[model samples]
Target: MNTKKQTGIHTGLPKLLLIALSLLTFTVIMTACANTKSAFPDSEGKIKITATIGMITDVVKQVGGDHVSVVGLMKAGVDPHLYKASQGDISKLDHADIIFYNGLHLEGKMVEILEQMAKKKPVAAVSANIDHSLLRAGDEKMGTEYDPHIWFDVRNWMKATEAIRDVLIEHDPDHAEDYKNNAEAYLKQLEQLHQEITEKIASIPESSRVLVTAHDAFGYFGDAYGIKVMGLQGISTASEAGTKDVTSLRDFLVESKVKAVFIESSVPRKAIDAVIQGAKEKGHELKIGGELFSDAMGEDGTTEGTYIGMVRHNVDTIVHALK
Candidate 1:
């Protein structure tokens, strides 16, 4: 496979794992059901919602609460832009009442599949509620018709939360009030998060307020915090940081005396190290600030495993590094 093809192919591993887990869970439940006919009363069926990635799945669970069971199609550390659904995923989708995805092209190769599924069932683009003006122009980057990483900004993510609530209400109208209340609560939390991040970023010295990363995943974040951000690649995971992008960033870092550059949890670090090495060649050394949760959240069973925790950890890391 070609370089881009290889990247795309590997991205499906997470989805495959999720699909497998869902199938396993389903099988276990079915076996239990077969053994006991009257073990539990089955009068009402719960709504099943599936998301393309963990972050979206997290929000859906928060909003849907006990009325819905949410599944994240992508596993931790997987890139949603390159994920492909497996046969197991098809089975999971076949049974889902409603599905949610981070649209605006974040689900790369899976976009078309999701679209086809939408025609047959209820599948809403959670990111559709995001204002177009707020979206970053991904025109300059390859395969990025428009940047789809709005979730980077807590405020922008409120839009996603609202969209999720709307979709849930549409499908499960009996629990409309519940979804609204949950969405409101989540939105309040997100607003508080936005304020906290602004304060934390503001604590950094003005001269040192630069966010450099493996991919252009922080445009929304940079816009929110007044920090100058640069990414080696475009919004699309398919775009690699070529020699030219690295050379330019290195020159800028050395000239500006940038203290630290960050690597992302999901993206490879080779490109970031190359930037640091390039700066070193120019007689300046830049430290690795910290790993940021860019396209994916941290591993399970960690504080950074949740959306709130991930944002807090990133803020803490950046403030400590740049301040």
Candidate 2:
């Protein structure tokens, strides 16, 4: 799940390794030869972009059209909470014309490296302009940072899409017209998708609107579509689900008669399985609703590969299970 962070859990690299990575980033910044931004307007080739997650990569590709070539560091089912960039990913960041990522501590372990690179290049977080009031506040255990699952809220993602379009226009002014046209078309599609999701969710019986999943990744989704969401784990998979947590959730399902529980593609299924067993012991026959794309989108070339596709899949899956 490339859209979250955690504390007191798996930091991708040990403390010593992170220090070395910081030093290496500084050295790369100092020695970097190309200033992609200065040369961007005149460059005949596609703008080379390195994005941290597939969602951002898709945005860049869509807005930049034929003008940009983008690569995402995190792939399908790769949890960004635990992702550590390799030497190759560092090289990609160093060589890119511009870099984009989800901020709000989503890519926790890569923070230092990204900051080091931003000193020399155009590195932007797509959620840079989201109002603080719009974000879901985190609890003390997760610190005071806002939740990073902004994409689950279609409105926030539309803002992010516009941000990507504007950045591409600013950096590659020659393609401003194309970028503008592409963004307008894409934003319209997103508007339609948002409406579709809203109406579809409204069809589910109000009493069956609870969505149980492996983690709290769908908090934004739940808020946006009027669903009551419960997770076995906290916001980040870095924390483990204890017996007490499972028992409590199980008791809720039994009491509420919740129809189904979902498994996340990026999270482990063991916790979900335990919850199901607990529910069964209490006489609730909860079905596994469907595997939802929470932290990571589906694989490339599939319907779930695109951001729109992923959202549609989640909503449709939820509607089927709950209805």
Candidate 3:
């Protein structure tokens, strides 16, 4: 009887040990999974981010600091309105951990592609947080539901910075403090930029504050800075200005006694040139003020390539030419 009892006890001990080992293995796996779920990219492991335009890319870089590696799809002088994603761009988007775009139909041709990619990964519009009341309406010709050029207004861009900061925090809680600090710094810079622009624009006498350009990209800018903006084409560069449009703008320039009109870096100079010719034909000589960073920033690695630099250059040009 004693021997039988000993054998039973020994067999039961092995079964209990087996059960304990299985439970231990299960707990280890679940803990590893939880860690993986919570982990975010850090300096050791950088996040891969893709931005649609240079403006968005610049902001992301400033906010993300060193924890992120960003790839900007559209380069300087590239028109986002008509830009379509190439195969390489599509591949980049697919591999990115996150994506940022201007939205509001700004990237008109890439809208569908972005929508599809959003299903598999986190895709954000930098302008998502901007108040709708602050936005301008788009004309029917542009096929835009709203004017997509929100970055022209410094205030609007500030809202976008907040949005980007919030997204980075949500994704990388480990670096939340870092992102917050960086965002605060960038916001302060933007505030300073706004003040500088205001003073410069104020230097221009109110009557001569008329800004004419290739397209309706500067409506928000004019509204923010108290300048009256006129563009030959509609909101989107996809829309072309006809002879009638040029003639009408020319008449307005002559009647308003505007000293200078401007050409855009991304837009063809032909429309503006035509307007100039039309004004000359009517005996009103209007010079092209200077090339403005519209739809895109200046060349990469230049001061105008940055968001703050682009805004400053634009204000300086406008004030110098129109003042």
For residues 36-61, write the lDDT of model 2, one tens digit per residue.
Answer: 43323344578888999888888787
RMSD of each: 13.6, 14.0, 9.5
In angstroms, give how far residue 242 of model 3 lies from its true place. 0.9
Worst 10 residues of 2 by lDDT: 33-42
Judged by whole-model lDDT over C-alpha atoms, candidate 3 comes out at 0.90
Best by lDDT: 3
Model 3, C-alpha of 64: deviation from truth (Å): 0.3
Task: State each model's CA lDDT, in order.
Answer: 0.83, 0.87, 0.90
Q: How well is each residue in 35-76 modelled by candidate 1, as lDDT tens digits?
A: 332321231367866677778878988899889866666777
In model 3, what is the error at residue 264, expressed in angstroms?
0.5
Query: Model 3 reaches what TM-score against the true structure?
Result: 0.86
